[model samples]
Target: MLSIFLTIPLTMHSQSLFEYQWKNRLIVIFTETSNSREFQKQMQILNQNQNQAGLNDRKIKVIHVIPDKHQIVFPEKSGWQNSNLYQKKESKIDFEVILIGLDGGVKLRETNPVEIEKLFDLIDSMPMRKAEMRRNDN
Candidate 1:
């Protein structure tokens, strides 16, 4: 939820992923298409109303990566962003999910559809998340 509306200049779009580093944790979903089964399931899991509070609390921003189009769909934004992070050749799989931490590192990788709570649990177990919880408890 941190700086969710902040806009970055186009010149730095290549480093847009790092633009979120330290400010928010990321759940990047790389899928073949926005309408794929895995993509739909993932979106369904994310759109649940009950998960809103937790999602905001954890500062999670979801990015949908359409490898075929070589673009990333950032939340609260309108069109696709061309990202070099995704290359169809680089990933042979059709559906892949990656959890990135505040330090700009990949924390988890899942090939199939995963539940939201599972992701939340994984994030909650992170050392940085522990520290963040401690800080918020004050």
Candidate 2:
């Protein structure tokens, strides 16, 4: 069952789960157990490419926060990952990856070992993403 879920691919699952309403600017991320250093490095690369693309820099903004359960949330897995960052009282957050939209909506969520190109494609294809960019330039 786990393998089935894993095989579904983050983008496809997220799109369906989000109902394609995810299009046109939002946050997308691939999180994993923090102990996975390779995942972190991959995330770094994704961010770098995104930065160069000027995607988040223009209209939309993408962010990745590493949640520290002990420091941020006492119980840790108690919905902290799903909780709205603003709603949480803790000053710190722990997440393998987080994608938030300009409107503060979550686009997609997943664990690491993802296809980075798919993420980039998703960003490029957002209908509103480009519009937001144009609006920002003005």
Candidate 3:
């Protein structure tokens, strides 16, 4: 596994998805608008499990993207834009949750709100996470 402290910050803009690519595992919430019920439910699950056993110690970051609103909300702040990060050809019209790994790859994608336990299990099963655990034990 790559050393956590060695990751680089990619960039800053109306959307900063790449900024977290190598530094933290990202749970990106993409919605048509911030008012979606599914988005709310997913956010609630993340909030509830953020500090729980399987997730707390891991470097996880959350990014909320609302294409209709042209906004991106990070944990500490949010940004608004006239244009969206999702282009017309690549955008998903429905609500979606995307889990990006520290290696800058999409690890998981779901159309429905996910349970925290399930998310944790998926994350814990990753090879990088397994190596992290081994390193910590030593």
Cα lDDT tens digits for candidate 3, 3-71: 322221222233455576557887777777778899888867777644444454677777676653454
Per-residue CA lDDT of model 1 for 26-50, tens digit only, reads: 8778777768898888877887888
Candidate 2 differs from the real structure by a C-alpha RMSD in angstroms, to one decimal, of: 10.8
Cα error, candidate 2, residue 69 (Å): 8.3
Count of steric clashes across candidates, in order: 0, 11, 0
Q: TM-score, each model? A: 0.80, 0.41, 0.73
Ranked candidates (lDDT, high to low): 1, 3, 2
Model 3's TM-score against the true structure: 0.73
Q: Which regions of candidate 3 deviate over 4 angstroms?
A: 1-15, 49-54, 68-75, 79-83, 88-93
Superposition TM-score, candidate 1 onto the true structure? 0.80
Q: Rank the candidates by TM-score, best first.
A: 1, 3, 2
Pick by TM-score: which candidate is best?
Answer: 1
lDDT of candidate model 2 versus the reference: 0.39
User: By summed lDDT, which 10 consecutive residues of candidate 1 come out lowest?
Assistant: 2-11
lDDT of 2 at 134: 78
Clashes of 3: 0
- Using lDDT as the measure, which candidate wins? 1
Residue-wise lDDT of candidate 2 within 47-95, one digit each (tens)?
Answer: 5654545543433333322332211111112233432322221222333
Q: What lDDT is reached at residue 56 by model 2? A: 38
